[model samples]
Target: MSEFFQQPPRAGNRFHTDPSLRLLTQWHLPDAIYEQAEPQLERMGALADEVMGALAEQAETNEPEHTPYDAWGRRIDRVRIDDSWRELMRIGQREGLVAIPHERAYGAHSRVVQAGLVHLYDPASAVADCPLVMTDGAVTLLQEHDPGLAEHYNPRLTAREGAWTAGQWMTEKEGGSDVSGTSTVASQDADGRWRLYGTKWFTSAVTADMALALARAETSAGEDQGLSLFLLELRNADDTWNGLEIRRLKDKLGTRALPTAEIDLVGAAAVPVGSLGGGVRKLAGLLNVARFWAAIGGPAGVGQLLALARDYAGKREAFGSLLRDNPIHRRWLARISADYEAMLALNFETAAQLGQSENGGPKELARLLAPLNKLACARQAAQTGSELLESFGGAGYVEDTGIPRLFRNLHVHCIWEGTTSVLAHDVVRALGAPENAEAFADDICRRLKNLTTAGTARVKQKIESELDVLMPLVNDPREEEARRIGWGMARIYQGVLLAEFAEWKKSAFDDDAGFATAELFCRRGLVDEPFPETDADTAGRMAFGS
Candidate 1:
């Protein structure tokens, strides 16, 4: 008897192969920008398959090495990363992954184009997207604050040749979100130059050429509001760490290929970006950009798993036939596709808002949308990423198959920008403003009307009911229920956006995907809360394992 063996799945050009991505462009982007973006997206997709995909695998195997000393035991404190990792940065640089929006080549469509490229590049990036996110954030802040810093850093950050990445240093033992208690104190030297002295509890992308950090100025007497943003290079002319000590690299669960470290600033030479006071406010631009990146990352991560799962279904066999032919597997794949497609719509919607904001559109919408996008997409990705992993059966559990990384890396999205709960609170706070709440509700209602006009009345009604219930909760939300409030808003946002696009798809392309996705999002995306019947006593016991 012959032994049965499963064949490995194959993936083609990520951008070119995915209909939803193309569909989104057609739905959201201008024809002129779409025409220009399509070819570049094609190139990125090919590179994603032909080049970056292999690099992602290699980076996984050749994890970043943190060498604390040299060959002769010189205390260099070097974080040596894979050449493949280096190439990934170069690929992003050459491809204008972060530069697209700043370049303004496509005008207001720039962010949409950029989102498309990054969405395609992410799966193959092995979390190299981490540095790119920080770098993009750095670019946004520098451009808005200091002219000289922007000139010096923006070119290097956006370089097509020898590009550079930047780190985000904010966390410390004192707090993660609470910057008021940060112990990293900034003091000026005799020359009036700034320097930072304290420990950075969790500094990501430490191997980057530069970083934007938060430190409380020594001269400030106030509490949280006294924090300042400082720009610092990673190395000196002699290739030594610039007043920075890499205490140790973190042993993280995922993103092992991306170097994350705990650093002690030994008088790290720095330059203040803007006014010494309100550093957190100045850094908010960077945070917004980073949050957007995190939001897109959700779709990127899950989309990767979906591709692999769909491919695997065609190749792997079950009791009697290929998994692709199995009704259960096909149904699961359909739901995955629906969820993935719906989230993709939300990503581009947020991206479009960002693009418009650059060209003088409503900035407040983007602010509210950022938190909504991050919270919604992160939860969806986390939930579905794990399910998609199970679609591979035991093969997903194995490290070698490269499927687990999709899910493993997703955990950070929920925590990185802000935990789902943190974002929920932000949403609640943002919605506290009557104008913001009104604008948010108006946007959803408008989008839902499009689907309603397209004859998806049940879909619109379901979402309308959700909004009716959800609106009151966010308007006057409890601390514990903040997550539910945020998620409810995000889900409604996704559903309406999906419905709008499905309307376009139905009329323009006559495709069922948009209708299917819209219906699924309304049905599965919106919910009344988890186990409302279960008492707090039962829920507490279930959670505590008591």
Candidate 2:
């Protein structure tokens, strides 16, 4: 059996053969894009695996006694592995991850979603709220403390510049995802310094070195209008919490590894991010960047979950046969495989588009696609993982099996940047905008018409057939109808796009063995499934002529 599986040749192992890792490393960069970034990506992956592996091993033994904030710490610690947290800052500095650094100073954010999954699972507990609020607070503080540190990407800085390992930014409280509702106050001191005073909830505030907090600058001739981002260094010169307080932690279902803290910001020393009144817009840039990373991290947990379930099926025997041999199990594998591939393709494209911001590219388009990618991929990851678990029968429910952990972790991604409903509204809003609605619609049409692969073409035709039924309703511009149309079009367009890429990959370009695994994404994402409701709607509409 050992000889058969052969341990999927590890990156540096004697005979490691992990197809997925190889796929990620190889196909992540297209030929045109791979030439420059390939080496960096590979190095990053290797470093990530090394740090992550060490942490995983430590987690097994160091399982600290369950504390309320363990989830938050664990998640942050997971991201800090090797140099991921630092690397992210470096990437942001180089070109502003999604136009936050170069264009907006406060957009220097981290991948809390990835860390959140692991942290939420930590023994310590808390109730769930927006993690982005916590991230905002952390990012602001770091940039303020070291103005030049935001752009530090070189490995040498890891040793030279001492900074907080990981922390969260807390901006949203009752304001929902709307940052304008923020009421935290920052008053200038008599000694010519600034201090923060307010109550903030859903703060992923940890025992880190700094925090990025948003508050209204204090003045006597008060206007509730002035909002600013402040970087408050939480740790003292001796590394102690001086004024910031973590009031209580929330208890939650998924992402227990990261604690959701209710923080009391009383006389917390702070500095502003950009201009005082410009904080909200600055945070928007940060949120946009956060949204992009959330999209990327969404699939990470899901992929891990699928791999776990696959391992379970391969090992567990039932009804006088191995689970892997069952046709039902095979079908489940195929289905989840398709979901993962679709998500990867969508996110990769989104990231690539975001990277183009440096060349004066269309950022609004990236912004439009960002929410869709975040919401769609995160939702899909959770749903897909749950479905995959059902295939494992009773075994998956057991904690020792580890399927539950992955399922819970993936669940957090859906609610992170924006909720599903929030995302749906955003997509509709984008569609209604005069600037891109027609172009977006036209883009959908072209994708549908092109029909890149046999597998995708069929799916595209099926979605179109459904859209035709909803056409009359869509033309009216009602929010509900528009949302339905938006979702359907995005999915269909994605299918077409994936199929086209699949066809391209199958052409003469790729020959490397590493691409072989990643190629699975191209083929699997293009597979067509039936959509009878769409077809039925179109038929009914055509017959009624109303």
Q: Which candidate is the best by lDDT?
A: 1
Q: What is candidate 2's lDDT per residue for 357-468, written digit by digit as tens?
A: 4245665556567777777787777788788778667766876555566577666667776787777777776656655555555666776677554445545555566556
Cα lDDT tens digits, model 1, 1-546, are 999778887667867667887789777887887888889999988998888878988888899777888899788897778899888878888898888888899998898899999888888898888888888888988989888889888998987787888998988898887777788889877777888999998888788899988888764332343678889998999888899888898899898788889999999998888777778788877888899999888888887788778888888888999999999989888888888887898889999998898788888788888888988887888898989989989998998888887789888888887887778888877877777877887787677655546456767888888877887876676766777777787778778777777778778877756767778767865755744677788889999988
Can you tell me which runs of candidate 2 are displaced by over 4 Å? Answer: 1-28, 32-54, 57-168, 171-173, 220-225, 446-456, 466-478, 481-486, 508-546
TM-scores, one per candidate: 0.94, 0.70
Question: How much lDDT does candidate 2 score?
Answer: 0.52
For model 2, state the Cα shift of residue 208 in Å.
Answer: 3.1
lDDT of each: 0.83, 0.52
For candidate 1, the per-residue lDDT at 79 reads 78
Question: For model 2, how big is the CA root-mean-square deviation?
Answer: 8.9
